[model samples]
Target: MTRLGNARLVLDNEIRPGGVVFAGGLIGDIGEIGPGGDGLDLEGDYLIPGIIDLHTDNLERQTQPRANARWPSRSALVAHDAQCIAAGITTVFDALCLGDIGFGKARNQTFEDAVIDIAALRRQGALRAEHFLHLRCELPAEEMPEMLARAIEDTHVRLVSLMDHTPGLSGQYGDLVRYREMRRAEGLAPAEVETVIAELQGNHHAFHAANRALVIAAARARFIPLASHDDATETEIARNAAEGIGITEFPVSLQAARAARARGMRSIAGAPNLVRGGSHSGNVAVIDLVRENLLDALASDYVPGAMLEAAFIAAAEGAIALPAAIGLITSGPAAIAGLADRGRIAPGLRADLVQVRLHEGLPVVRAVWRGGVRVG
Candidate 1:
């Protein structure tokens, strides 16, 4: 048995000083520190459940670090996995976009390559962190239906999120002027940017509702979990609930998040938003959602490390207790994803754990273990 003691244990819903015993990749026992054990001592550092990220686009960023640069797909996959492990995420849902909205052709390539690369790496026992797919479906894209059809059958896909990035509708376009400026900064000529924006808006008007229904139907047929992205109003929340979407990935306003909570759907806030203190596009702040008790979980979104950091940050800000803060990234996400075997320090659960130390009021990951074996 592998035993760890003398540490602050972050349990499912509480934090205390304790230890745990493990064997055969399962938590065998959890309680006060034993007087004698063969395993290593934790030395009073904070030991929390390994983070489970339900949605993250860090892999896409790794695959295409910049506008004009692209790394080898397989190399990017390995780097992405390593980064996840180092961030103390034992289970990761790599959120890859399935539909292109004219931003970059490379995104489609990255999606295809990521699916193949992840499967190959997992089959070869080359991945340190558990990898799963979160399909991000862009409802306005004409090719979205075909793209979803092509990848929905993949065994690794466990979650699908409906996204509408139509300018003046959702996501980065919540602020049209800012969105236009972003496109121009991407090196697109002013006229070209306006033309593309017009085309996107037209596509949204013509296809969003139909494509959203199709994607929802596809997810329902497969029994895959469904998430609604960047919901901005109570109407969107009500519509999503009526359509049986169980998770709200990023509600953009307090009213939307409250509506989701009232509908019994989980509200996921981005960890990066909490870490940065506000939304990049001037939407509702995550701290505000926490204050209102509207946020149910926190996703890494784009930064894997943000999961761990945000938990500590939220706790330090006194918005919630540390254990409750940890739940936003750990038990909260795992439960949202329907993962029952991991995400907490409990007997008979998967032995996925992280050792963290606070330095100057910031949590720093010191080590990680998945399945009772150190991997980072």
Candidate 2:
């Protein structure tokens, strides 16, 4: 048994200064004003639930830094897992792009294979953090259905999202010049860029229908959570909800977010957007979503540390209460991912917790525990 005392415990809906006890990998007890026991004292620091990250592309970045710059799957998985633990994330859904857009390094079969191999390694006890899969389906890719079938059948996929990046369709890549610049930075030749764009335009309609059906079928068959990425319009949000997608990730406008809420679907925004004060892609501001109470959760899309920081920012900015802000990283995400056993500091719940201290008005993680064991 282990006891953590002298901490501000962020409990279900309130913050109480108390001590928490853990045994058998679950929270044993929590009470106010407890004396010293045979465990460590946190010295009045903040004890928050371990972060549950639902969407992150960091693994894909680790797998391929640039075009043709591939790293070994084992090394990348180990390094990614370590980073996640150090960032205070006890649970992570590694988002892998499943498509063959033929424009960047992430469009290759090796990306899919790496996901399978990493899941296998994690099952063999070679990973530091609890890992799951979130497959991103690009609608214009011809090979999307096959990849979705393989991922769903593998049983490691817990979430799947429909992402359409066709230049004019979703407005996500509306700036064609910017898109070309990004492609050029990846060393794509002019001819290759033109060819890929032409192919995407030519197959837009057929690919959209096929990918949408595949996503819905796979999610229904496997009972996996389905999400829509970068929803830009009210119609798009309605269409996705009608197709049984229960989560809206990074809606481009407040109208779309409100539409999602009306459909009883959660609206998720990237934590980095809140930390940076706006979206890097020029989408809707996350703070607006918070103020409107339309946001259900915050995802650490690219930067893992942004999750905790955003929560603190929301509290400090008066956008939400401390407990509500913390939930965006903890219970909110865990519930969205269907992880009911974690994200709360209560008896019988998994002892995934983080000891943090506020430094210059920002949350600084001092340590992390996963399943009653110190991992970072």
Best by TM-score: 1
Please give the range of 10 consecutive residues that has the lowest summed lDDT in model 2. Answer: 102-111
Give the number of the best model, judged by lDDT: 1
TM-score for candidate 2, residues paired by index: 0.94
Candidate 1 lDDT by residue in tens digits, 1-376? 8889887899867788888889999999988883357766888889999999999899988999977899999999999999999999999999989787869678788888988889999999999999999999999988888888889999789999999888877765767798889998889999998898889999999999999889999999999999999998899889889989999988888888889989999989899999999998788899989878888789998999999999898899999889999998889988888899998889999999999999998888898999998899
CA lDDT, every model vs. true structure: 0.89, 0.84
Candidate 2 per-residue lDDT, tens place, 6-61, comes to 89999878998988889888998988745476678888888999999999878766
TM-score of decoy 1 = 0.97
Error of 1 at 140 (Å): 0.9
The 10 consecutive residues of candidate 1 with the worst lDDT sum are 34-43
TM-score of every model versus the real structure: 0.97, 0.94
Clash number for each model: 0, 0
Query: Any runs in candidate 1 off by more than 4 Å, and if so which?
Result: 34-37
Query: What is the alpha-carbon lDDT for the whole of candidate 1?
Result: 0.89
Superposed by TM-score, candidate 1 places the C-alpha of residue 145 at a distance from the truth, in angstroms, of 1.5
